[model samples]
Target: MAHPERDTDSAAGTGGDPGSWPARQAPGARDLAGLDARICRCRACPRLVEWREEAARTKRRAFADWDYWARPVPGFGPPDAAMAIVGLAPAAHGANRTGRMFTGDRSGDFLYAALYAVGLASQPTATHRGDGLELRGVRITAPVHCAPPANRPTPGERDTCRPWLARELTLLRPTLRSVVVLGAFGWQAVLPALAAAGWRVPRPRPVFAHGARTTLRAADGGAPLGLFGCYHVSQQNTFTGRLTPDMLAEVLRGAAEAAGLPVAHAD
Candidate 1:
């Protein structure tokens, strides 16, 4: 069955400049809406499909009345965004339930608030899709679309999901100038994906750390893409003060500056 948000012909993901990308380069050949439609319908990984379906069927106690969005969650935000936020994956009860990235989760709670504070998101709370939460200069995506067991995906799963992110990044290349990576996992995942999508990642690879920043050039000699790292907005981090709200805001502010966005920060 087709998803409600699935407008396959909308084609928002393929608007970026082609530059020197070969005409036959297949990574980002399809438009975003088309890719989104394809993503939501995927059942390629049997384990993931089983897990996500089970999560949707066996509702969390707090969300017993909710109808879960058991499908893959696609990237969120406008196609021309200058900055992107790369996360680990969906939360079984959060995005897996709400059909939107970062919606209805504490991690999202920390993230959206920071984006809102920095003038990227129009509002802080991302409870569900069509909740009027809008992002101007930023978009968010994850390597794995489905929520995994204990929030950890296996190496095989990560590699299986790599092409989707690579294609998405290629499509976003024209306007995307910076990427704010959450956690070391996201940092590691995005580097190779961008490299595969024709971005020239630095040799020896840049190290990942809280507030670490690096740049990767396009293989076709286009503009560089800045990368800024932040601690994951997981409850484990926020509850322990390893990643405070102010700390998140600081990283986003720096990312916006790096992406050439015009947003002022009072933090």
Candidate 2:
């Protein structure tokens, strides 16, 4: 269901700056491996820091026996990913508990299923960080690292955490050809981050809508990157049919194809 702009010359290996993503000049290049480590120790926002820690301490009855990550959830997948998925933030009982995006949550269950069906994911269930789920060519990240209260991040919280997302994109710009935004919030957050990281943004910007697609470049000389929009795979949406399996699959499949990933391959 992606719009026509999903595939472009930039995504076809002509994308990326001549040395657009040099190893040394990227946003915190020496820190990509250690990025997650730093994120986990962040206490930048007083409100989020307190909320995430308190939730970890007062464990939900269903997860009383579990030890929560209680820190920022870093992006997961290969460093040279061709495709990326961005979300709003971590779920209090989901990534906060399992230390992996969408892991140990119903929302994850729904998404992983679709990713698996399209051959992007190694498994359909992400039970834990060690559950062995693998993404073939896609990476998952979030605009906000920590879990926010009521699943809502204040404007300040989002801006405060954007550096992480921007840095990740800068590092991945060399190979990332497409991005799938999980919600409108993510769509809004990623645009500026990409532009700041050197991706060109059209004047007036593109509107967020299900199946909407846009193409931009890292810079005038950099490769073009495709952006696709999809409804968030939240329980309210899934349970109410706002986002159905078919709908999710349609978007992910289109993204994978644009990123030059095969629909099915035995691994």
Candidate 3:
């Protein structure tokens, strides 16, 4: 498979002033591919840049032979997706290593498994970007693109990264009909992006809860967007009974149906 990261480095340098790239580049992106290319090169947050690069250099023992991506991971899936899955951020050794959201991690294992079971993903596992995993009508993304220290990004960092999410939503506005926000962080972060992208978020902002559901009308009077909240597929939730296979499938199936996509019976 072609290693696109090698080419991305040179392009990133020419963009100028890493801290200002998102605000400057995001709105002007002509399409999803252009936006993703811009997202992959961001180095806006000094702390996150240092942390992601350090993790790549230190090299986790299990992946010692890997050429770590060590860059901001962009959203994965087709451009004209009807459903969107929003997560908090990439894992240090997961997406940070493979350069694909949810790849090389247990969280991805759980997520892809559920997606496959629901007939969205082409396969049940995502080991790398070139592994041939594909989503039929759904797109997966996150609030923060870089892996933060201890898997937590500061509020300032989240705000700084808001333009990317907002731009991504704007690009997907034509077909994006339903969203499954994983965890409270993603829920909190995505609401404003949705509003900024043309959806009219309800007053008294919606609270996050497992199985929580709401609808946001479009400012352009387009199709309404359905928002569903689900627990993060982190080990903490999956290892315990907090989030089960059936629970995840239920939410995904509902979202898929809401997006007017075909749903397969859960396995």
Worst 10 residues of 1 by lDDT: 17-26
- Clash pairs for candidate 3: none
Q: What is the alpha-carbon lDDT of model 2 when measured against the actual structure? A: 0.82
Tell how far residue 57 is off in model 2, in angstroms.
1.0
Q: What residue runs in model 1 are displaced by over 4 Å at the alpha carbon?
A: 1-29
Report backbone clashes per prediction: 1, 3, 0
Candidate 2 clash pair list: 15-223, 16-223, 198-218
Best by TM-score: 3
TM-score attained by model 2: 0.88
* Per-residue C-alpha lDDT of model 1 across residues 1-267, encoded as one tens digit per residue: 243444332332233322111121224346666566656655556677778899999989999999999987889988888999999999999999999999999999989988888888899899998899999888899988888889998877777777778888878888989999999898889999888767888889999999898888888988888889999999999999999988888889888888899875783
Which tens-of-lDDT digit does each residue in 1-267 have in candidate 3? 222323323455356666666777788777888888888878889999999999999988999999999999999999999999999999999999999999999999999999999999999999997889999999999999999999999998898899999999999999999999999999999999999999999889999999999999999899999999999999999999899989999999999999999989943
The per-model lDDT (C-alpha) reads: 0.82, 0.82, 0.91
Ten residues in sequence with the least summed lDDT for candidate 2: 1-10
How do all the candidates rank in terms of TM-score, highest first? 3, 1, 2
lDDT, model 3, position 105: 95
List candidate 3 stretches off by more than 4 Å. 1-17
Clashing pairs in 1: 13-32
1 versus 3: better TM-score goes to: 3
